[model samples]
Target chain A: MSSVAVIDYGMGNLHSIAKALQHADSSVAVRISADADVILAADRVVFPGVGAMRDCMQALNETGLAETIKTVAASKPLLGICLGMQAMLSDSEEGGITRCLNLFDGHVKRFAEGLADTEGNRLKIPHMGWNQVHYKPHPLWFNIPQDSRFYFVHSYYAAPDDAEVTVATSNYPQAFSCALAKNNIFAVQFHPEKSQTVGLQLLQNFLHWDGAL
Target chain B: MSLAKRIIPCLDVDNGRVVKGVKFVDIRDAGDPVEIARRYDREGADEITFLDITATHHNRDTMAHVVEQVAGEVFIPLTVGGGIRTLEDIRRMLNAGADKVGINSAAVFNPEFVRQAAEKFGSQCIVVAIDAKKVSAEGEKNRWEIFTHGGRKATGINAVEWAVRMQNYGAGEILLTSMDRDGTKSGFDLLLTRAISEAVSIPVIASGGVGNLEHLAEGIISGKADAVLAASIFHFAEYSIAQAKQYMQARGIEVRL
Candidate 1:
C-alpha cells in the first residue's frame, strides 16, 4: 500500500486534494509535523496551498517542514499544487522578494509585462480558467492523454531554470510551462482536482504511475 | 501563444445549502458545501466559488461558517462572496481559509472596502463580482446596468465602468455574471463580457449563460475572459468540466486538455 502524506502547514485547502487522491484509491493522510520520521515513512507526499508564497514559505520554515519536505522528495513521489507548486521555486516576487522551497531550479515571476499573443494581442494577468496543457514527455504524463485540460488560477507563473524539467506547457499570450517533473518530484501550476475527468484521470495516473512502472 | 482559458464551478449557498437559478426558480437542494466541492474537485473543476446569496446587512457568521466548511474540505483555491461589506468580512473569510473574498453590492455601496481589503490582504485576495443586466426602452438601444443583492437591486452604475473602478480599487479578479443569460444557458454575454474584460487588468471569470463546452470556449476565446464560471451546467450534470475543457481544446481555446 502506498501511503501519501499531505503536508498541512496551516495553509491551503487540504481536504479537497485529499479527497481526490482518496478517490483514486491512494491511502491519504494529512501530515503537519516537521518530524523526519513521519515524512520518511510515507510513500508519497503532497504540498497544497492557496495563500501567498511568503506565508507558505514561512510556515514551512517555522515548522521545519521545509527540510523534511526536501528529504522526503528525495526518495518518494512529491507533488505541489498552486501556491505549493509556486513555493517549490528558488524564489518568488510575491509580497516582495522571498525565498522558496527551492526544490526545483526556478524562480516565480509576476506577469509584469502584459502578455502578447503570437499575433501581438495583449492578454491580462492572474491567469484564471481552464487551459490546455501541451504535455511534455515525462513520467507523470504516463497513462494520461497527450493533450489534457487542467484548471489554473494564479497571477504569477513559474519559470524553471532548467528547461529539461518542464513537463507540460500552456499558451496564454505565449507558451509557458504548466507542469514540471524531475525524478520523484512533480509540480503542476493547474489544479487537477478542479479539472473534471481529465483532471481526475491525471490524478489516477499519478496514483498508479509507479515511477514509470 | 494565448493563455489557456479556465473552467470554474460556482455554488450559490443559502442557509448552508447549495441553492441556485436565475430569479432563483426551482431551487434544487444539494448536500453540504464541502461534499459538493469535493465532488467537483474529483470531477476536475479548475476552481470553485461559493456565493452566499443569503447574505444581507447582518448575518455574516453563517456565510463565514459555510466558507470554513468548504475551505477545510477543498484543497483547491476557494473564492467566497456575499455580504462582504467591510474589511472585517474579508478578514474572516481569509481566516477561514478562503483563497479570495468576493464583493458585490457592498463594493457598489462602499468602494473603500475594496481598497481596504486589498491593502490588508493583498490585491490577489480581493475579487469584485458584478451582476449585469440589459435595460431596454422602446425604440432605443439596450444598455448595461449593474445589479447587486443577488441580482435583486439594480445600481445605476455602468457594468464596464464599475469593473474598471473595482480594478483601480485593487481587485485581483472580477466575477462578471450576466443576469439575463444566467440559468438560460444560452451562452455568455460576449459583448458585455468583452467590454469588461477589455477594461480591467485583473483576470475576468465570465459567469452565466454557459450551456455547453462551446459556450466555455466562446466565453474565453470570444469573450476574451481569463476563465468561464458556470453553475447549472456543471451542477445539473449537463456537462462535466472535463468534457467542456475538451470541447474548448478542440475549438483551439487552449484549455487544459
Candidate 2:
C-alpha cells in the first residue's frame, strides 16, 4: 500500500480529504505527530483544513508540525489545501496580519469592493459553488480539461508574487490563480476532493507523478 | 464573463428517510438521505438543499445529525431547510456543519427573521424560500403569490415583492418553488421564475416541475436562474446532476462538468 500522510492540525474536513485520497486508491493515514521521521518517510503529505487561516497556522506552530512540514516540503511531495493552501502563502489578511507557512512567495487577500461592474455578472461573495478552471501551461496539466469546473468556498484567494508559478487560473470577478506549482509543492484555490471524477483524476495524477524534469 | 450558473439537487426528507410522491401524496421510500447525498456529491452537484417535510409536525429542530453525518462524508456545501424559525435554529444548523440555512414560513410570518438571521450569521448564510402560484389574468401580468406551510396557506404577497424585500433584508439567495408545477413534472414555471430572478439581485434557485435534463438547462437559461433545483428526477434516478450538467454544457451553458 502506498502510504500517504494527511496532516491534521486541528482543522476541519480531514475525513473527506482522506476519503478522497482513499477513493483514488492511495492509502491515507491522518497524522498530527511532530516527529520528523514519520513525515519524512511518507510517500506523499497532504495539508488540509477548513477553518480560519490564523487558527490553522497556530495549530501548526503549537504542534511543532511547522518544522516537520517545512522539512518534508523541501524533500517530498507536499500539497496544501483551502486554508492549508492559504497557509502556503507568505501571509494573510484574515484575523489581522499574520505569517503563513511561506512555502510559496505570495500574500492572500479578500475580494475587493464586492461589486464588479460587468453587465449581467452580479455575484455573491465567498465565491461558493462550482466555477470553471482554466489550465496554464504546466506538467500538472496532463489529463485535466482546458475548461473544467471545480468547487470553491473561500473568502480570500492567493496573490502569488511570481506569476510563473501559477499552474491554472479561474475567473470570479476577474481571472485569478486557482492552482500553483513549483518543484514538489502544489496547491489549488478550489477543492479537488469535492470536485468528483475530475478531482479524483487529479489526485490519481498526483499519486502517479513521475517528477519528470 | 457572464456569471456562471449553478445546478443544485434538493432532497426531501420525511422522518429521516427520503420519500417520493406525486402531488405530495402516496409517499414511498426513495432512498437513504445520506446515500443519496453522497451520490450527488460525487455526481458534481454544485450545492445541496435538504428539506425536512415533517420537521414542523414532528416538533423538532432541523435535522442536525443528518447534516453532521453528511458533512463528515461529503466536503461540499450543504444547506438545510424545514422548521427553521429562530436564530437558534440557524446556529444549530451551522453548528451541525451546514454552510447555509433556508427560511420559509418564519420569514413569511415575520420578515424580521430574515434580518435577524442574516445579521447573526452573515447574509451569505441565509436563504429565503418562496413557494409561489401564478395569477393568470391579462392585467395580473405573470404575477406569483407566496405560499407557506407546505403550500397550505396563501400569503397573497407578490413573490417578486417578497424576493425584493428578502434581498433588502440581507438574504444571500432565494429558493423559489412553483407550488402549481411541483410534482407535476411539466417543467419549471419560467414566467414566474423569470419575474423573481429579475426582481432580486441575489442568486435565485428555481425549484419544482423538473422532469428531465433539458428542464434543468432551460431553467437556468430561460428562467435566468442561478440554479435549477429538482427532487423527483434526481430522487428516482431519472437523471443525475452530471448528466444534466453535460446537457447544459452541450447547449452552450457554462456548467462545471
Candidate 3:
C-alpha cells in the first residue's frame, strides 16, 4: 500500500491532481495534506499550485509546509507541477519580485511583452493550450514518446541557471525549460493532470520511480 | 510548435443528462453527460464545456453531481456555465471539479460579478459567455447585440463593446455564441467572432453554428478564434473529434494528433 502525499498549501487544484494520481494507479493511496507528519510519512510527495507566485510563497511560508517540502525533497521522490514548478526555482519576477523555495538553481521569468512566432503574428500572453515537449533520458520519460504534447496555461516560464538540471524543453516563440530533474526532484511547467494520455503515463512513471539521481 | 487551436465539444446538461436543441428550443435528449464526456475524452477532445440549462434550485445539486462525474472521467479542462449568479454558485461549480465557470445572464445584469469572480478566483478560471444576435437598423452600421436568459431576453449591450468590457473586468476568456447562427448549422458567425476576437487580447471561443470540419477551421483561420465549441454535430456522431483534428492538421492549423 504505497502512499503519496500532495502538499496543499492553500493553492492549486489539489482535487484534480489527487484524482489523476488515483486514476493513473488505483492501488496507490493518495492523500492531500498540509500537516508535516502526514507529508513526511508518504512514499512520494507532489507539490501542485496555481495562482500568483507571491500568494503561493506566502501560503507555503505561513503553513510551514516549506520546510516540510525541503525535508521530503532530500529523501523521497518529489514532483512539482505548473506554478509548483516555478516555486521550486530561486525567485520569480511575478507580483513585484517574490522569492521562491530555491530548491533548484533557477529563476522564473515572465514572457517578454512583444513575443511572436516566425510568421510575425503577435502571440497571446498566457500561452494557453497544448505544446510539444522535447525531453532527454529520464525516469519520468520512461514510456512517453518524444515531442509529446502537454497542456500549458501560464504567462511565466522557468529559466534554470544550470542547464544540466533541465530535462525537457518547450517553445512558445523561443525554447524554455519545461521540465527539470535533479536527484530526487522532478518538476514540470505543464499541467499533466489536464494533459490527456501522455500525462497519465508520466504520473504512472512517477508512482513507480525510486527517487534516484 | 504554437499552441494548437482547440476544438471543444460542449454538453448542455439538464438534470444530470446531456441535451441538445436549436436556439434553446425543442430540446432532445442526448445521453448521460458523464458517458458522453468520457467518450469525447477518449476521442481526443481538446476540452469540454458543460452548460447546465436547468434553473431550478434542486437541479443545481444535480448539476454539481454531473460535473463531479464528468470531471472524474474526463481529464481535460472543463468549463461549466448556466445559472451561475453569485460567487457562492461559482465556488460550488469549481468545488465540484470544474476548472472554469462561465457567466452569462448574471454578468450582463451585474457586470461587477465578473470582476468579483475574476478577483477571487484567478482570471484564468473565469470565462464570460456572450450570446449575441446581429442587429440591423436604418442608418446605423450593423452590430451584434447581447442576449441573455438562454437567448430569450435581449440586452441593448453591443457584443464587441461588451467583450472588451469583460476583458477590462479581468475575464481570461470569452465564449461567444451567435443566436442567429446557432442550430442553423450554416457556420459560426465569422464577422461577430472576428470582431470580438480582434477587439480583445484574451482568447475567444467561437460557438453556435458548426456544421463541418471546414467551419471549425474557418473559426480559427478566418474568424481568429482560439477555440471552437460545438454540440449537435458531435452529439449525433456526424463527425468524430479525431476527424476534425485531422482536417485541421492537414490544412496546416496546429492540432493535437
Candidate 4:
C-alpha cells in the first residue's frame, strides 16, 4: 500500500493536512510524523507549517528536522505549503534575517506596509482570504481549473531567483509567485487542505504523481 | 481578476447545533452546524466562521467536534469564534481543524492576552473579534466604544483605537461587529467600519446588520471591509452564497464566482 508522511516539526497543526490527505485518497496510508525515518520511508512527503520564519527555523533546526527535510527533498516527491513553501527558499527577511532549507534559490519577503490598489484604499496585510491562482500546465494542476480561487493567509511570499521554476502566480494588487515546481518537488503558498474542491483535486494529483515531470 | 472579497457565513453554534441569536439574544435553532457549513461550502462561500456561543463548560467540546466533522468534508477556511480565552483554547480549536480562532471579551479584559496569543499561535490564526456600539448622541460628533457582555455594558474603550491597538499587539485580522445594527437589518455602520478598517493594516471582516446582497457590497465599497460576514440572511435560506456572490459581482465587488 502506498503511504504518505506529513512532516510534523512542532509547528502548525498536522490534523488538517493529514485529514485532507486521507480525504483526498482514502487508499493512501497517511501519517503525521516528527521522526525522520517515518518520513523517509513514505512514498511522498508533505511539509507544512505556519508562524514566524525565525520561530519555524528555530523549531526545525532544534529538532534536526531541517536536515531531514533537506535529505527528503533530494529523494522524494515532496510538497510544501504556506510557511513550508517559504522555508524551501534560501532565506527570508522576516525577523531581521533567517536562513532556510535553500532547496529553492529565493528569498521570502514581507508585503510592504502601505499597499494600495488603484482605488487608493490601503490593502490589508497578511493577504488573508481567497485569491485566484493562475497556473501553467503541470502535474499538480491535473484537475484543478485554471485560475481557481484558493484560501490564503500569510504575511510573506516566495520570490524564487529562477523565474523558470515558478508555475503559478497570484495577484494581491501586484502579481506574486504563489506556486513553484522543480524536479521532484512542488510547493504552494496557499493551503490546499482548506481550498475546497480544487484543493482536494490538487492533493489527489500530488498523491498520484510519481515525482516525474 | 484580483483577490475576491470574501463572503463569510457566520454560524453561531450552541451545543453542536447551529443557532442564530438576534443581537446575541432570542436564540433560535438553525440546524446542524456541520450541515450548514457543508451547504455554505457547496454554495461557494469564501470561508466559514463557526462562533461557538455555547454557554455551558461541558458543552464547549461540542464545538470542536462540530469543527472536526466539518473540517474533514468541507475543504475551505474555517474560523471558530466565541469563548476562545486562552492559548490552550486556541490550540484545541486549531487541533480540531479550525484555521483561525477569534478572541472577543478576553481581549477587552486583558489586552496583553492578544499579544501572547499571537506570539504563541501566530497572528494568522489569532483573530480579535471586536463588538462595537455607537455611543455618541445623534447631534454630536460620531463616536463608538467597546461593549462587552454581548454588547450590553459599555467598556468606554474607543472602537477605532482598540482595533489599531489589537493589530499593533499582533492580531492578524479583526472581526468588527456593529452592535447597534447587528440584528436590526438596517445595514452596517459604514462610518464605524471604515474608521476601524482604515486604522488597522490587518484585514477587517465587517460583520453585523447584513439584510441583503446590497448590504454586503456596501460593506466592501463604503465600509472598506476586506470581507463581509452575515448570518440569518443565509441561515434561513433567505439567500444562498452563490446569489450573494452574483450580487456582489454585478456591483463589481470582485467575488469568487
Kindly list the per-residue Cα lDDT of model 3 for residues A5-79, writing each as its tens digit.
999887745788888899999999999999999999999999998888999999999999889989988899999
User: Tens digits of per-residue lDDT for model 3 on B87-117?
Assistant: 9998888888888899999899899999999
Task: For all candidates, state DockQ relative to the true structure.
Answer: 0.28, 0.21, 0.66, 0.88
Task: Quote each prediction's TM-score.
Answer: 0.74, 0.73, 0.95, 0.97
Highest DockQ against the true fold, candidate: 4
Off by over 4 Å in 1: A32-37, A118-121, A204-213, B1-13, B16-50, B56-80, B84-101, B110-126, B132-147, B150-161, B168-170, B178-191, B207-223, B227-257
Pairs with backbone N, CA or C atoms under 3 Å apart (clashes), candidate 4: A196-B75
Better of 3 and 4 by TM-score: 4
Using lDDT as the measure, name the better of candidate 1 and candidate 2: 2
Candidate 4 local Cα displacement, residue B228, angstroms: 0.8
* 2 against 4, candidate with superior TM-score: 4
DockQ of candidate 1 compared with the true complex: 0.28
Residue A116's lDDT within candidate 4 is 92
For residues B1-257, write the lDDT of model 2, one tens digit per residue: 32467778888887776777322122233456777787787787878889888786452443777787887667666888988988888777776767788999999999998998876666667889999988667775577899887788888998899999998998888899999899888999998888887776677899999988888888877887888888888777777688888899898787765
- A14-62 in candidate 4: lDDT tens per residue? 8998899999999999999999999999999999998899999998999
lDDT of each: 0.76, 0.78, 0.88, 0.90
List the candidates ranked by TM-score, beginning with the highest.
4, 3, 1, 2
Candidate 1 local lDDT, B45-121, one digit each (tens): 66788888778644467767776676555656688887787777777777676778888877888999888877666
Candidate 3 TM-score to native: 0.95
